[model samples]
Target: MRIVIFGGTGFVGLNLAEVLLARGHEVTLYDRAALPLSAQRSLADYGARLKAVQGDITDVDTIDALVAEGCDAIVLGAAVTAGEDLERVSPARVLEINVMAQIPILQAAIRHGVRRVVNLSSASAYGAAGQRHQILDEETPCDPVSFYAISKFTSERSAARHAELFGGDFLSVRLSAVFGPWERPGSVRDTPSLQFQILAAFARGEPALLPAPGIKDWTYAPDAAEAVAVLIEAERPRHRLYNISSGAAWSALQWGEAFAALHPGLECRLAEPDEKTFIKLHGGDRAPLSVTRMADEFGWRARFGCAESAAAMSAWWMQHKEWI
Candidate 1:
């Protein structure tokens, strides 16, 4: 299969590209940012099976031309992960990139007869509703609050509506808090994951301070990528929406503590009362996303937990510490 991932140079996109390329599929990454040198070196083994293209996602001509050439599947991973600061300063930019730009891409997919279109959405789409519910399922009604959350929810509905009206095979997956290899600070992404922050502190030879436990069903990037790949390869999925999650709750502090134990110089602990800390948690903890839909439909479940992910990510950082 030939797959095109928008925002492919970003964190999750690179992970997904590696997954697809390893499965003997050709991957084309379309993004404005250049691929990081670490990623370029790591992906070098794939040879010509991987291609990276630099272009503005809003440019319909470029996107459509690429899609028309021959695309078996499309993954809509481009987004502006805005926080309150960005939302206050550039709200329109958030909606434009996260919502409006997606329309042309979806239309191109439909026009070119692309087999499957998967939209990457965030668990933030659940918003305040997440606080009310114990388990967020695909059918849960969303009450999105932040600009980023609103855009993701809107994109999900727009993609599903386009499929419904045009008879296209479009689907959306609501991903839980994702953090693993390849996550880094960028222009579009204002908030780095807690795990990334902890790792960065470790790299700086400083202790990591936590604002809170930062508990949530944090999904590993590779696991989340594999779930998206499953959807792209499915012959005919039963539903239009699925929740990709770890299916359990854990704290970033726990993972950090586990990681700190691996290295004698590392220290990860909660901040003292009223003490200033560099680590920033996204928001107050909310309900974990339910993976029942993914499990029932495809027998899928995230393989990594707090301790396992800590070990795996520590090994990865040892090889590519420069990436942090």
Candidate 2:
């Protein structure tokens, strides 16, 4: 299959591109800038199966040509990374990149007759976890807490609606804390409550900070990439919103202890956040759509556990000197 990925040069996009290429599909990566050195290095491993193109999502000509270049599916991974200050990328720009850009692109795809589309939505859309006990399934009403989440949720709805109106299939994957190799710099200092926290602390030379004894599911990048692939390959009705997460919950202290044990030199601290600083969890009680949904239906499984994923990421960062 030939696939075109918007924002294929970033973290998630980069990982997904590799996954698609490994499956022997022709991939065209359209990003705003040249592929980063890390991504270039990884793509080198794929040789010629992948084509990396630098292009703007706002450019109609660019969008048309790329869509016309022909692709069986399109994955929209292009957006501001979560945790970014919404004010940093003004609402106009956020709406432009997250929502407006998709209009032209989706129009192009519909005109070009692309079969399927996968929009990468964020778990942030559900706001802080643990705010509610019921799991946020596809049907849960969203109360966006930040500008980033608003843009993501809005963009997803727009694209999915467009696909429905135009006679095509669309699926949205709401991703949890995704971490792995080729992770962009920054945030290595203070990781999230989930997987990246330990890795971040190690990278920043700070003691690891674990969350209060609260539960949150952090999905590894490979699992997420596989989930997207599974959605692309799955038949229609089965294609609605799927929560792509590890489906396993762990507390902050547990994660911190595990991480501290892995690296002897690293200091592990049990520090609580100040009153002003609090972490939010998307607490949904419902078991995420069972993996059976992905396996029996789409043939997908998470190959790495949290500890295993953390170790693998740490090793990669150490190898690249990214964790210095």
Candidate 3:
């Protein structure tokens, strides 16, 4: 399969590219930013299997031309993720990137020979639907709180509508807290993961400053990538909106403790957030994402827990030292 991923230089796209390349797929990564030097070094082993191409996603011609290159499937991983800072500074840009850009991207995919189209959505779309502790399934109502969430929800519906009218297989996957290799603080996605923070603190010999009891269903990047690969390769998928997550809940303290255990005296613990600083976990404890649908239908499940995932990331960071 030859796949062209928009925003392929970004965090999730990089991870997904590696997964597709490992599975013997040719990947053309189109992104606004060039692949970071660190990523180039890390993925050098893949050689010709992966190639990063820079282009403007909002341009329909660029999208059409890329798809015309003969792609098996197209994954729209391009978007401005959840971030208050981004919303405050450039709310309209968020919509322009996440929602408006989808129009041409989707049109080009169907216009070309691309079979399956995957739009990366976010669980933050749940918003107030996640106010309580209950696990959210595919059918859960999404009440977007922030601009990012709003764009994600709207994009999912909009793409589905387009697919209905144009006739094609389109999917919107609501991803949980995804973090691991290739995931760094970026302008498109600035939210830092608790695991990465802890690891960084250990490396710097500093105490990790975390929001108290930050808990959510965190999915490792490789696991999320595998689930995506499965969906892309599936001959027949019954649903359009699917949630890809670790399928289990974990806390900031747990990950901090796990890292501390591996490297003693890291002082991994939570710190109360003042008005200016914090990690927001307003969804409360154990806000698990119900992966039963993915498991039951596609026979897919997340393989790493918080501890194991943190350890794996630690090894990766050791090899790719410049990422942290």
Judged by whole-model lDDT over C-alpha atoms, candidate 1 comes out at: 0.93
Off by over 4 Å in 3: 272-286
**Model 3 weakest lDDT span, ten residues long:** 275-284
Give the candidates in order of TM-score, highest first: 1, 3, 2
**Stronger candidate by lDDT (1 vs 3):** 1
RMSD of each: 0.7, 3.9, 2.2
Q: Write the per-residue lDDT of candidate 1 for residues 113-210, one digit (tens) a residue.
A: 99999999999999999999999998899999999999999999999999999999999999899999999877789889999999998888889999
How should the candidates be ordered by lDDT, best one leading?
1, 3, 2
| Cα lDDT of model 3 by residue, 127-223, tens digit | 7778764889988877788898899999999899988999878998999888888877777776777766666666676777776757788899999
Most TM-score-accurate candidate: 1
lDDT against the true structure, per candidate, is: 0.93, 0.70, 0.83
Runs off by more than 4 Å, candidate 2: 82-84, 128-130, 185-197, 210-214, 235-237, 272-296
**TM-score of model number 2:** 0.84
lDDT of 1 at 61: 97
- C-alpha-based local distance difference test score of model 3: 0.83
